[model samples]
Target: MSSPVTPSLTYRSPPGPLHATLLAGTVPLFLGALLSDIAYYNSYQIQWSNFASWLIAGGLLFCGLALVFALVNLVRAPKKAGRPLVYFLLLLVMFVLGLVNAFEHAKDGWAVMPAGLVLSVVVTLLACVTAWMGLNLRSGGPA
Candidate 1:
């Protein structure tokens, strides 16, 4: 009787393009939430009670979902790991910081926050723009 042959046990690498784009998609989505946090970081002087919390919470939820989806696709098909990974990591940090601000805001009731309200506008805008661009890339042609 003849012996059966076996395939190579080494792991093969997939094309990098797919992972690149997946990373790219994470950007705009993360920004969507991050930007919202910035917009509402400190409305206490503006004296809008709980408004920042509401906006940030909602934004985070949406962005978080989008980020997860993007990451998942990258994992499943790493060819999409574009620049969005860097952007996503940065935005993720901003989001965490925003949440911290939210906690502080709750105690102080919008007392300019430790970092002040400016963070809200800047971060929020950046997040929005980045997330938008990232998502837009996903629907484009030619990878």
Candidate 2:
């Protein structure tokens, strides 16, 4: 009689509690940071440039925290487990873009606001994707 085949194992390990926490926390943390910055701008004589700075700072902080978590998890994982270095590099790229966008927003008028908005969206999406990858990587097995 024929039998069903099972998948083979590789150098992957299931994500642990820390992975779960980091994965789930990243989005909310970013959103909260962004919202806080927005709310801070509600005062009189609001300076969008300042708001941009706060937003950039918030995004960078989130990325930094996420990178640290990924590094720690990767170190603890089995040698066969895939490294999350790509995510780390991507986060760094987002950080640089965020800084650039912040500078654009600091310029007079809203001429570059559209570009800044696009950068913000991209950064947020990247953060989510990176976190999701971390969450799933926890259950890794041999390639």
Candidate 3:
């Protein structure tokens, strides 16, 4: 009987401590933003309030903080990592969407809310993908 052959695969560890922390931290913030939005819309009618304002502000602040972490890692790392770069870009896009959402709320434009919701979902998904990539990053250490 012929012995079965096994396929070999190389394992790669995640990024260093700082990068890993930043990436791990971002995922919860993204989920929080999504959940906050969902909770706000579900419980309240179509009207703005201090609570809604603060909820959004907090979410954006978290995203911004996470972005800073990613950006610092991108700049300080010996070699530029593509995942951090992509994470930075996604954060920027999410920030733009946040601006649009804020403007739409301020303008009392109910019609644009659907677009805002869709954008939020997209941003959340992208954030997840970015975090996943960050989690898979090979630690830039001596091999």
Candidate 4:
């Protein structure tokens, strides 16, 4: 009598180094932008707003690249019913919000405040969530 055969399992590969780097880069840049926005709100310094704008631009660049990578992974994934899809969606939302935040930051003077600060907060949180999901979640299944 032979022992029962076990089925093979397939696991989703973790993100490549470049993708991981891009995801990791977004969080700090967005967080820095939020901090700068808060500083500008409190101190009314134009320089702080400039800093926030630059930081938001960097965050958007990194996020857009990461979103592309996530999209590619989602497409290439053999099974897309779980974390991969969710990860891609989260990244998509983060990128869109970041873009909006960047546009808000582009406004001049008092117009940049309030809305810019609020958008910075929202975009930062979304970046954190997307980075966490992209880095931690792995989808797997039977081959």
Highest TM-score: which candidate?
4
Q: Is candidate 1 or candidate 3 better by TM-score?
A: 3
Q: Looking at candidate 2, what is the lDDT of residue 117?
A: 57
Cα deviation in Å at residue 104, candidate 1? Answer: 2.9
Q: How many residue pairs clash in each candidate?
A: 27, 13, 0, 0
lDDT of each: 0.49, 0.57, 0.57, 0.88
Question: Which residue ranges in model 4 land beyond 4 Å of their true spot?
Answer: 1-10, 141-143
- lDDT minimum window of 10 residues, candidate 3: 47-56
Tell me which of candidates 3 and 4 scores higher on lDDT: 4
Candidate 4: lDDT over CA atoms? Answer: 0.88
Better of 2 and 4 by TM-score: 4
Per-residue CA lDDT of model 1 for 32-104, tens digit only, reads: 4334435545332333435555555555555555556555545654344444454456456656765665554
Badly placed stretches (over 4 Å) of model 3 are: 1-44, 47-53, 139-143
Provide the TM-score for each candidate, comma-separated. 0.54, 0.59, 0.59, 0.90
Model 3 clash number? 0
Give per-residue lDDT, candidate 1, residue 136.
47
Over 4-31, each residue of candidate 3 has an lDDT whose tens digit, in order, gives 9875543454456765665556556546
